[model samples]
Target: MNIGIIPMRYAKALFAFAQDKGMEETVYAEMNQLARSFAEHASLKTILDNPVLKSKEKQALICTAAGTQVSDIFVRFIEMVLHHKREKHLQSIALMYQDLYRKARQITIGSLVTATPLSADEENRMRKMLMMDKEGTLEFKATVDPEILGGFIFGIDTYRLDASVATQLKRVKNQFMDKNRKSL
Candidate 1:
């Protein structure tokens, strides 16, 4: 069986089920939390994959990792996943559900990384400028990363614009090295 197919199938079912129950938004939030838990805790996968852990225990762990409280639809989905011994793909399922939700709702996810934090006005201006050419609602998140040295990196969906000083310096360094090699 294809590994990717399993998560997609499960996620599609969960998305449809949540929509039918009018809990899609709640489930989406829970899935995002669950996905973040998986990313932040590498041991989570190892614990879920442990053979000694009972289904109930794993279920409890997953529910706790999701958030303070999850929707009934999410709980039922987790039960179904545990019942089918698909706990190993829980992370992927959560991420897939998020993707499905975002696509269905026509939400565009974007991120801005800069050496320094932008003021609220600046952030709003940036968001407005970026949204000018894009369709649908934009969910913009700004993060600070001093490693970039200066300037900013903007990304919307799969497209990324890297104008950071560090990256430019690296490109210049690479070009110098190549020239030196050619001259040698």
Candidate 2:
């Protein structure tokens, strides 16, 4: 997850290559699923990282774990990574590829966490407020977290709006503490 330029560079190249080859859509889905598989199957990395296993064996294991859902090109992509000894960073590369795909397609993935679920009208209003424009699609996932107390936390990529009551209360508490410190 903490990968840097290597994965990003690989993902950009892959994304561009897929686009040129007219396989962007197929490869994008495969990359996302590949990243998710790494997350869902913890042992996948352990198995892949086993130096005792040959590169071909590792590639076969990855392809098997990936199943027929992935395209032949994607399988070859995995093989290429194994061949280059970059298997360990495959998860990061997959994640970066998804990010690149979303960016290219103008898809913004965001999360809305609230103390409670939003009503139909409220949800629509929130969408309007957050989306700002009609060109890009907002892929929003909603979650209820009572710990927020009230309001909502809207997050998209690196940006986050924390209007939750819990956060507000913490700010007030910090202000009060600052005031008390000055008096003392």
Using lDDT as the measure, the top candidate is 1
lDDT of 2 at 161: 92
lDDT digits (tens) for residues 1-184 of candidate 2? 5467778888888888888889999998778667778989999999889999999888877766665667777877787788788888888888899888888888888889999888989878877777886458887788999999998898986789999999999999999999999999
Tens-digit lDDT string for candidate 1 (1-184): 9999999999999999989889899999999999999999999999999999999999999999999998788888889999999999999999999999999998999899999999999999988898898678888999999999999999999999999999999999999999999999
Number of the top TM-score candidate:
1
What value of lDDT does candidate 2 attain over all alpha carbons?
Answer: 0.84
Residue pairs with colliding backbones in model 1 are none
Deviation in angstroms for 29 in model 2?
Answer: 1.6
Cα RMSD, each candidate? 1.0, 3.3
Clashing pairs in 2: none
TM-score of 1: 0.96
For model 1, what is the error of residue 64's alpha carbon versus the real structure, in angstroms, after optimal superposition? Answer: 0.7
Counted clashes in each candidate structure: 0, 0
